[model samples]
Target: MLQAKMKNGQLITLIHLSKKEVEEIKSRGEEFYCPECSQPVLVKSGIKVISHFAHFAEKNCSLAENGEGAYHESGKIQLYNWLKKQRYEVQLEAFIPSIVQRPDILLTLYDKKIAIEYQCAQVPIEIIQNRNRGYLNAGIIPIWILGANKFIRISQNRFKLTPFLTQFLHQFSSSYPLLLLYFCPITSQFVKIQNIILTGSGQAFGSLSVKKLYHSAFPSLFSVDNYHEALTYRYWKREKEAFRQNVRGKLYGEELAWHKWLYERGTHYEYLPSSIHLPVKDQYRMKLPPWNWQSRLLMDILHPLSKGHVFSIHKAKYSLKKYYSPSVHFPLIHSHGEPILQYLHLLERLGYLTSISDTHFRKQMIFPFYTNVEEAVKGDRRLLEVLESKI
Candidate 1:
């Protein structure tokens, strides 16, 4: 509601006018209304909040629900100004007639159109997906930047990533890691959560970099390579130990069933080898936890095969139907296949499997099973050393 249409059909932006000029307009009894809906709106000039036009309380406008208090408005205005300063063509609260959706800010570059959504409030994942679909159909790339105030900081390089928040993550390219973007209007800082590695369903360790809006440009957001490998390894070691120690705790749903399945195979969950549940960047996209899917792969597919026996991707995907998530579109990120493939590749890199073809892989070494948790931890250390060398 930063820009409203005057009665004469001229656009008036309250933020551009001085306080004295805004008072003069109000004293002259000028009438302004919403630019999109063309409904009567009143200019609100308050001491605490930014000055803007608001629709009547009884009127329901599409933008009203997505609209929020001054914090959200200020952030939208700031982002719009920042993009404009970069010399990109920008529009505020642009209503795409074809999609009937209004993005907070729309930008048109040389040959590409992008929609920037500054989300300051929590919304359903379904709504987010729907908006993404609409943008894709219209040939516009949608970008979501969350409010930094909502970021739950757990440690220096870790944060609690809720299922709801994961829907907003973006991946610019295949080589780049999945990233979360956050902006703080209060401090004019942008926090990019880069190189994310999920330690659990709701927990992840990553590098958090905060820079002023003016200090970083648009392209800088796409290139994020800085990370702490030693810190990540230490964190993963701690998580592996916690997983082994917490095995006897309460379980539910697929987790409980998976444990029972392991028992039927004459093996305990804690005795599973370290190779299972190893780190994979795309593990977050799976329907089941790493332990569930990884254990299933070993117990059902890889362990039973004789030396030199090969398995195809189709066989792997079908055998692991229980771990497949419902088909969901992840914007800008191409999940190569089931996340288990990444784990298989890691095993390949460790000299256990060899890639014979695009769809088939041959088993080289027999599955390694540790006798107890102590041995499993040591195995993980060796795995970490190999992984570090590649990194």
Candidate 2:
């Protein structure tokens, strides 16, 4: 939307133009056309708004629902300037003909090409996926940097990570950890959240760090090695306590259904063993909440087996196939490993199970239910002591 083609097939960008030049463009009486659709467009420039070209309201273009506000415009310019000052090969609103798309800022570093998209508004998930697929298919990596307004921070270790927000999580390379980036144009501050681990719907545990734009470089995003994984464990400990207390309130949907199942088995939330509702590093890929599926596996399979009986990971996952979300749920995560193994390994460390092989686990000690909430809290405290040491 920033670059348009003249009638003579010459491309013009308004990013580095002066107000006098913009006034002359308005008086030049020359026609400008959109690069993507080749349709006539009008130049919009004023004191309040940034200089750019817009397609007519009646026309439909893929780039129409993009970078509309001066906030979006100003942020892209700052980021482009930052990269340019670092002596990196960067372009503003670079259009790719093969993909029929234009990224906000495209940076070509070394042998790799990265398309940086500065997003300030909410859009459909399918649109995000389609754009990512297009960039990936063209051998380019797409990094989506969300606006500061899009980030809802609950605390130092807590984040309200809705599905729309999670769609923007970026894994720069296979060796790097997962992270989400946010920039506040007004404040000139950058917020980086690394080692993001989803615990439940719309909630996660991560290490959040903030830095000014001028003090940071491109490699800082990937190489910042210092973070407190202990904070993640602390957040999980609090969530487990809250999970135990939720049964005192009115339950609905999956929670209500799970309560009914517990009633038939003569068990309640406070009576559940410490193993239930524990955290897994990749709970985002599962359709059911941790308690529902973990409880089901314990009651239906693991709890009924003899102490020496062994179970295969294949058989366990097959029995609870409906609880797992497809691998496509998390497009940004490159390495897809089963989350159940983490839970099993945790149980193994806590003396409930033993690893017989890479794919099989043998039952070691049977799990026990608590008689009261206080006793359950004690069990959690004891279990988390070992869990924290291992983490």
Candidate 3:
């Protein structure tokens, strides 16, 4: 906790308090109380840790349970002071009485109140959801900024997307690209992952941007960046090959069922069509990985259809509802449309299906199948070439 209330009902912060002021404050013997619980708090100063308030260990306050460490405490103050310099009305560790929630930094933009939570520690998804619900009920928008230590960068544009990290993904508007924000106190760097494509259950590729916190402004966080289609497909080629290795590694669970289903279809993993696991921009809506549901649709739905046979996405979605994650699951995204619709469009481009209507498509040609890995790799490259041209 960085803020405490004086006996005179005045709120004071140790964010910019000097050593002399700290000593003077301790000498005065004035009592300082917590703003959240209204309990008496002690001023703590150390050689390494930032000077701040700490509740008594015996106290049983909800805020005391948070235990915001030195990393979170310093980062919160840094962001608060950074935002304050831009002339934006920013409040540090602002406690909202109506919601019984305290955001690390609360910024007011006219009528809109945005609660910025700088979460350095890993917390349960339910805690995050409950807090967000409380803030939204009070008509306050909540933005969570992760500590850069959680940013799992596997390559230049590639990263691991764990279930915990997905909650931070934000899509401000329909026209804006989805992104997540990351800040590191030690490095003083801010990382923005924009235009992310969810390729697997836990893997994603995105346009990554890193800049010093001092070099950035508040509005810059929402700035849209161009999607690198060439770069995506270039790296996707490697991921496509990795997909083959991954399937062989999995021996049980839903993947085993998928393999058994494929076996019944008179085909095996290596011999399956190259079109199975291609990228869908809106794939986050799917509960399963891109390969699983995409393979299911390719085999069960399209493979049996004769030339000119029409299929509707609506019916496909209903029949395969279990594969889809409900729209409500993505509270931060404004609109992702449909992964199936995008997949259909991709098939249309690849000559597997022809458009009949917005909801319907006609099968034009049978999906290509390769006998071996060498042939499959070539087919994948051809499809990627088509994608690159379209991009």
Candidate 4:
């Protein structure tokens, strides 16, 4: 195992230390139990790594993997030590019998007890709700510290939250203020904290400023409120509408025409479907390009039709006319060519086609033209018959 460097100029390895060495550290009174599971930890000795403690398990612990939970455990230890330095009466991994839940850290200030949950992964809403109930039943304040990239607090009466954020909020009502802490893995630090005000449904409705707590290095106070106007609900509605419009705008017109072309020719021609595997001449192969960031981006921007589904060009055009001016149609047509080229290249490379540059030979196509016709027909037998006659 790798060794960590300690501030005391001692290198500590993860290997088991002797009983005498463990006793020597305990004599110093620096030893502590795991806050979460009450497991004993002892400092190990090594030259290359700094001195650090490891849990002394009577039996092997399952949470020994090098992952987010392990990091959270380590962070909890560091945080507990830091809090102790500040003279706060704190308990690590304190279990509350009333709630049947264990909090990462519990701090008692006079009569008030606070339960802090350090979440490093996506936890279920039911779990959070049960835990929240447990803490509230125990007359303790529950605080959740989420991992960075999990959420962000936008403004008063308007916050942008994720599914995970929604789940966390749904379990606990608007009783306690939610503090959104952004954890930075690169710097190994808690970068910032935003105070989140939640709605009745547990959605984050707004945010407040943070007050730096530890010598401008840690946040001490953050407050968020003023979400009574249902602004977040309105903002979310508008955002969803805007996204729909953007998607439609990117995919309409000439792009619609390319989709129509695929729909009409897909079955007779061996066209590859988008992001699915289909049978080629003798074996199954990918119909569309592999799903990747760049390809997805291109698909979003270009709106190419999938070989698995046919595009109804006339219907799409009519729909576009209902919402857009005729002058804006052609630009969408010109934008889809790049994604088409990309699709064609992918198909050729996957052995669905013979050549990347060759676009004329219909037999080289992988998708059956019938897929597009199914889309164009849209459950109308007459339309199917008409399309079939044309083919």
Candidate 5:
């Protein structure tokens, strides 16, 4: 809707046109057509809304049916102009011939091609994945920036990760935690929620960095920040306490099943070892919450053997598969790596286990058990120290 083709096949954006120019073009009877479907479109210059093109009511264009509203139009234009100001070769709503997709803004950085999509409205998850795959197949890195208005702030440092936003999380490297990007055109601010470690299925604790659009360069988007060790542990401790007190709250859905499985194993939620529910950066990959799979790993894989028990990570991964499911749909997430292995590595580094072979580890010590939140926080503090060292 931002850019349309004129009768002469030249592309023009209504946002860049002056009111007088729009009036002159309308008076002269110049016609514009949808760039996606190549159907005639009408130019609307409204006082309340930004100038843009739209298809007629009877038209069945897919783009028109999607309804790119004023906010999306403005955001798209703002991003295109922002990238253009940096002297990057950029295109607005450029149609990709190979995939027949029109990315909002396409940028050519040296030899790299990037497609920036400023999604303001709710879209089907399948469609989003398809678009991402299309760009990936074309050798274009697709960067999805969410609308800042979509963020539901829960606290100073935490925000609600809606199902829609969860799919867009980017994990560039296994070492780098999941990161989210949000832009508010109204405030002209870009919010980068980086190094996010989810505390629960729906809640996350992370570093939120906000910068003005004009002040930040492109490379800043990919930069990861150190998560405050004390702040992160403080929040995790509270979550652990809540989990401890709220047994009834979790008696539903998959959690109920997990609890039943624990009951069969002669252990309950509160009695699990302190290390079971601690923060694991790569825990996002597992379907069950941290307590379930982490506890299962302790009970089934790590706790059954004597002190001399040596096991391979591959065996642990295979044993944990029933509890494992892809929780997030981030394409950049390393699919081949096991999140449980990462947790096992942390345990190894903490001196509870020792690496005896490339993929096998020897149990050095027994799992430490804690009776209260205070003891749990101490265990979490030790784990947090290992996590912070990676930063």
Candidate 6:
């Protein structure tokens, strides 16, 4: 502990120590615990002026692993080497002022200064907003070079819009040109950078390559407006709306058959009171016939049916076919009922069919002889027809 002389002529231990003493402590193999948290400090030692220590295990610690410090150190070294190769003034990880936050790099070009950030992960929206505000206040242009993981790692080939991401993208869509750089792990350097348009939904539009660097790849940048436009154009080109419209049109044709089938079935049975009800074993077996040659042919023609409806049909058929046959698996026949009901529930959720209420069925089933079999047949036929067309 370092001792200090107080004005009151009292000797006290000074909490604030010099950098040299801190270094000496580290060099002497003495663990430097955080004075604030009392946790072991992990130090990245032996630096050409870039050195810091902090608690690594604490989740709330400012130095928690975000790849920022490592990226900053490696980025500065890389930028310094690049500038030296280009015969330019080399200043790595320089500090700037606007709201008092220092950027990763400050490049001096003739009479102007440029601020650059090497971001390897998705940064918090607040941080990005703050950086933008600071850059604007400082009157220095800010450039962000994002890693490949942001664009290339996403599996969706077509762009999609989420409310939050869309808002974020729209905010920066036309502000500044974005530079996308691909880092090479082998060389521990950025191999290529390209200017890419980012849509209002954060989709990559197109790339413009740069080839000026010593490596085969060079870093590139794009204006925000161009990025947004390009992304919108790409999204429109995918044309999912047209596909949905086509599906809707085909569905309209088969709706008549389904209406007929439902009307003919009426609501005489207890299960028919609610569309959500599971069919009783005997009722389910008697209602639908097994998959005969004709039915099988029709199902084959309607190759692509909704998964829910398909499950219902297959379950009904399996249950009936196995009812009287003792040799057939009982579990397999009973197992299909749950899946069928689940599928019906899904269709109801999607707004394709209405639930059968007690009142509606009671009115139709007033007379014992008054079975609406014709309507049910027509509705079933229509439904099957529509499913066929979809397939």
The number of the candidate with the highest TM-score is 2
Better of 4 and 6 by TM-score: 4
The candidate that achieves the highest lDDT relative to the unseen native structure: 3
Q: What is the lDDT of residue 298 in candidate 3?
A: 83
Model 6, 1-391: lDDT tens per residue?
Answer: 1122233533322123445654665577644544323455554445343455545565553224344554455544565466567666534444453456555566777776667666655656556666666766677666555432343433333332222222122112323332344443224544232233322222433333333335532223232223323333233333322211223334232244433444564423211211121112122212222112112222232223332232234433354353332311111121223333333333344344334642111111111121354443343334333433442
- Predicted candidate 2 versus true structure: per-residue lDDT over 1-391, tens digit per residue: 6789998898998867998898899899779998888888999999987889988775667777564588888888888898999999998888888998799999998899999999998888888888988888899888888889888888777888887887887765566667889998888788898888887657787888988999999888667557655655677877888776654567788878998999999999788999988878767767777888889988888999999999998878887898887766566667766778777887897888988888899999998999999888877877777788876
Which lDDT value does model 2 have at 95? 86
Q: Rate the local accuracy (lDDT) of all candidates.
A: 0.81, 0.83, 0.84, 0.41, 0.78, 0.37
lDDT of 4 by residue, 96-203 (tens): 666656577898978989876667766555556666666776788776665544544454435555535643331122343334554433234553323333221223
Instruction: Score residue 108 of candidate 4 by CA lDDT.
Output: 92
- For 1-391, candidate 3 gives per-residue lDDT tens digits of 8889999989998867997798789788889999888999998886787989898776777668776688888788889989989999998888898988889899999999999999887888778778878988899988989988788888898898877788778888877777999999998889999988887758799999999999999988888987766877887888887776554764778878988988888887777787888888777778788888988888888888998899888876776688877766667777867888888888888888888777788999988787888788777878888887876
lDDT of 1 at 134: 91
Candidate 5, which ten residues in sequence have the lowest lDDT sum? Answer: 327-336
User: Regarding TM-score, does 1 or 3 come out ahead?
Assistant: 3
* Displacement of the residue 169 alpha carbon in candidate 4, Å: 3.8
Clashing pairs in 3: none
Order of models, best lDDT first: 3, 2, 1, 5, 4, 6
Per-residue lDDT of model 5, residues 1-391, tens digit only? 8778988899997777898888788788788889888888888886777788888665777678666588777778888888888898998888999999988899998899989988888879878888888888899988889888788778777788765677788877667767788888888889999867776568887888899999999888888787665566667766776776653753688888897898798766766676677777766667777887888888888998789789988888887787665543567454425678778886776677888888899998887665665566566556656655654
Task: Give candidate 4 regions above 4 Å deviation.
Answer: 1-70, 97-100, 149-160, 170-179, 182-213, 216-219, 224-241, 248-391
Candidate 1, 226-304: lDDT as tens digits = 6666666666776777777764668888778988898899898678877777777776677777878888888799999
The RMSD of every model to the true structure, in order and in angstroms, is 2.7, 2.0, 2.1, 19.7, 3.1, 20.6
Clashes of each: 0, 0, 0, 27, 0, 28
- State every prediction's TM-score relative to the real structure: 0.89, 0.93, 0.93, 0.40, 0.88, 0.39
Q: Give residue 337's lDDT in candidate 1 (0 to 100).
A: 38
